[model samples]
Target: MHVLITGAAGFLGQRLVHALAACRELDGQPLSRLTLVDQVEAPAPEIAGVECVARAVDIAAPGALDASLDEHPQVIFHLAAVVSSAAEADLDLGTTVNFEATRALLEGCRARKLSSTRLIMASSVAVYGGDLPDVVEDMTALTPQSSYGTQKAMCELLITDYSRRGLVDGRVLRLPTIVIRPGRPNAAASSFASSILREPLNGEDAVCPVPTDLELFVMSPRRVTEALIHGAEVAGEAFGPSRALMLPGITVSVAEMLEALRETGGEAALARVRHEPDPRIEAIVASWPARFINARARELGFQGDANLRDIVESYLGERD
Candidate 1:
């Protein structure tokens, strides 16, 4: 198996790389070559039998990924994007990277006639918005409210079309807000979700930009990485007419997250958190559906955290 991952320097990408390194195989074949791509050169993990190639390239630039595509990776995990708040703030940057770059990648696969290639893209719950049902389903209409969501929704359609045309096998996993991410905050509107707990647990003050009652559909980094890998192995026909899958996640409110933080990090940690509203972030997050009935994903054997406490503990365990 030749596996290539974009956005390979990001936290989630790095985690996925390590997970793949440990497994050393995918879809019943041994991983022989692993190519990591990002704006910055990703660290090449030293897998015993696998050749690791780390390339620094702007995937949005013309012919940027041509060399990597020449290698003809069996599986491509497309995880690169400009994130939410940043995308909303800069439409041009968002469109170029999120939408155009994705279309280009699909075109790359089509041009090379890599019909056996499986492209697993990381989408988001942000794709669902405006007058949503209490429990959103996989086939629900895509009514995106933000530039980031719109771009993702567009990519989902392109992937589906390409799959239908026999150009490429595509799997679109619509992810939930990943909670308890390690490291400093980025530009994602959901960054606060992880920051609140991560900062307080590290004995620093943190802000809550949304209301305490505001709810979000969330997953842990562990489960998201697992889904990425599993998405590659599932039969393409299993997706039927649509190639998109809304991953299963738990619906948690800001209050519940803080409570979980309190349970894991004690009173001092809880005291470190302060509430201050930011309407910009609040509107973006508010537009997203907080509940989902991902029956299809559940039937397909996808899993989520047991509860928020476990999510918090999972981060703590990793840190320890």
Candidate 2:
């Protein structure tokens, strides 16, 4: 089976590539080819019996997706995006990259008319907002506040409509804010979630842009990758009426997360975190739904981490 991944240079995308390389198969078929596309060249991992190609091309550029989709991959994981803060900061760049690029990729898949193709997209909980219930459910409405969320929500609708028409077999995983993400921080407002943990643990000072009590629905990097891969293999009929569903995640406050970090790394590590609030990030994160009753995702076999402690430890082990 051929697999194509966009944003292959990103944290989640890179992890997914390595995870797939380790599995050496997809849907019980021997993994044959993988085409990794990003604006910057992605690191091509050497996997036995897999033809790995890394292309540093702007997928949003005209006809750029052609080379990436040329293989007619059976499984496509679309992980690219402009992110929350960056999207809010630059509307034109966000619209071009998030919406236009996504549409182009979907159209590419539709043109192939490949019924067996699995188009698994990475969506965000930013898609939910405005007078939300105590806990978001499968039936909850999408009222996105940020431009990033709006773009993702729009893409989700497109995925649903396109799938209903059998133009492409699509699945949308509305991922929660993945915490303890490895690497340096990016423009995502939620980047603070990982930064507060990663930088301090690495013996550097980090800022907490939100209040101590600000809540977040989070999953670990490991679980996110697993869920994405699982989402790819699920039968379309199992999705019932909608092809999109929120993935399960644990809700924890900033204070609780810091406590877990303290336990794992001691008072000195906890001391590294200094609260200097950024109202922009605070508002963006506050508008996101932080508690979800993802019975649908649970029934579909997606899992969350044990707890914040486990998530912290997992990050340490993975990085070590």
Candidate 3:
């Protein structure tokens, strides 16, 4: 079967490509072809019996998606988005890339009669708002606080509706803040949490944006990828009203994160990080939900949410 993966050059995208290349269907069939699309182009990996096409194109460009999916992929993983800071910085680009691009892709799949196509989408926990009731039940509603969050919330609704109508088989994984992400930091507000610990481990002083007590939910890059792929290949009947899965993650305060880092990396590593909060970042983080009830995902036979210490150790191993 052929597969299509967007955000193919991104951190999660590249990692997913490597993982997918090694995966075999339950029936023991290997993936026939893969179409990797991204805004940035890279030298494609050579894999035996796999047609690897690396293309640089704005999927947001009108009519581009229709031309790309002529083969009608059996599976699609949509990971393209403007992310938190960019979405916050430019609302127009945010709505266009995050919300409109999603609709267009889903619509493209529909127009192509890809009824059996299993489309796995990457969403975020930001969709849930802050200041929830004292005890957040599994039944609490999603009330997004940021434009990025709002867009994610809106897309979840669209994904579920598409599944219900049988136009497509949809699985939306609402991912949490992925810690120990590899690569240089960019505009994402949460970059500090990982960067501070990561850079210091490399013997460089890293900046901490939020205070030590700031609480947030997090998972490692490994878990995010595993959960995402599981969502894509999972077997199930036509989904209920909600086709989304709130993936498992751990809730820890900034202090707890640093303590875990120190324990994993030693006092010298902790000493390399400097505590300093950027107001813009702190304010944005303050409004995000710290924890969630992802019982639905757990019941579906998916699991992650390993402790912070284990995540830190894995990240350090990758570094050395």
Candidate 4:
């Protein structure tokens, strides 16, 4: 099987690439060719039976993905995006990268008649917002409060329509905020979700921009990677008509996260964190639902982290 992954240079992209390299196959088919696409050149992994190709291309540019689509990869992992806060900050950039590029990619697939190709897109929990229920469900109305969420929702609909029309086989995994990401914080409003744990464990000071009681729906890097792989392997008919699945995740507040930090990294690590509220970050995060009833995901065999402690420990183990 030939597979192509966009945003192959990002943290999640890098993790997925490593996981695929370790497995050396997808859906029982031997992974023969792997194409990595990113704004920057992604490093090609040396898998035993796999041919890896890394390309630095602006996917939003006209005809940017034409050559890659011409290659006719059997599966495409669309992980590239502008992210939440960054997207919210720049409307044009967000629309171009997040929504427009995705539409173009789908159009390319349609034009080539790649009906059998599976396109697994990475969406976000931000799609649910404004007067949310105690637990967001698969069938919940998408009332996004952020530009990022709006863009993702739009893409989700487009993918669904394309799938329904038999133009493409697509699956959208609506992910929660991924916590304990390794590396310095980015522009994401939820960056503090990782920063609070990652920085403290690294012996560096970190800021908590939201209140301790503020809750967040989060998944660990390990679990999200597994979900991405599973999404690709699962049969397309498994998705039914919607073609979108909200992945399971644990609900934890900022205080709970700190407690987990204290457990794994000791009191000193906990002391490295300071609470300093930022209204912008808080508002953005507050708009996202912190609890979800992901029955669809569970039925589909997608799993989440057991707890925040396990998530913190997983990051520490990798750091060590």
Q: What overall lDDT goes with each candidate model?
A: 0.92, 0.90, 0.80, 0.92
Please rank every candidate by TM-score, starting with the best.
Answer: 4, 1, 2, 3
Those runs of model 1 whose alpha carbons end farther than 4 Å from true positions after fitting are none
| Candidate 2 per-residue C-alpha lDDT over 42-115 given as tens digits, one digit per residue, 9 for 90 to 100 | 99999988999999988779888887676788999999888777888899999999999989888988887766
Kindly list the per-residue Cα lDDT of model 4 for residues 186-272, writing each as its tens digit. 777788999998998888999999999999999999999999999998988888879998999999999999999898889999999
Q: RMSD per prediction, one decimal?
A: 1.4, 1.5, 1.9, 1.2
Evaluate model 4: give its lDDT: 0.92
Clashing residue pairs in candidate 3, if any?
Answer: none
Candidates in order, TM-scores: namely 0.96, 0.95, 0.94, 0.97
Winner on lDDT (2 vs 3): 2
Task: Put down candidate 1 lDDT per residue, 48-158, tens digits, no spaces.
Answer: 999999999999899989999999999999999998778988999999999999999999999999988999999988788888887788778999888989999999999
Give the Cα error of residue 136 in candidate 1, in Å.
1.0
Quote the positional error of residue 229 for candidate 4 in Å.
0.6
Residue 256 in candidate 1 has what lDDT? 94
Q: Which ten residues in a row have the lowest lDDT in candidate 4?
A: 180-189
lDDT of 1 at 112: 99
Error of 4 at 72 (Å): 0.9
Per-residue alpha-carbon lDDT of candidate 3 for residues 1-320, written as tens digits (9 for 90 to 100) = 78888888888888788877767341245777888888977345667888888878897788667766788988888998888778878999999889998898889889988877888889987887766764344577888887888888788889888878888888888887889888777678888878977888778888898888888778888888888778876764523468876778888888888898788778998998887768989987777777667677787766776788888888988778
The TM-score, computed over Cα atoms with residue i paired to residue i, of candidate 3 is 0.94
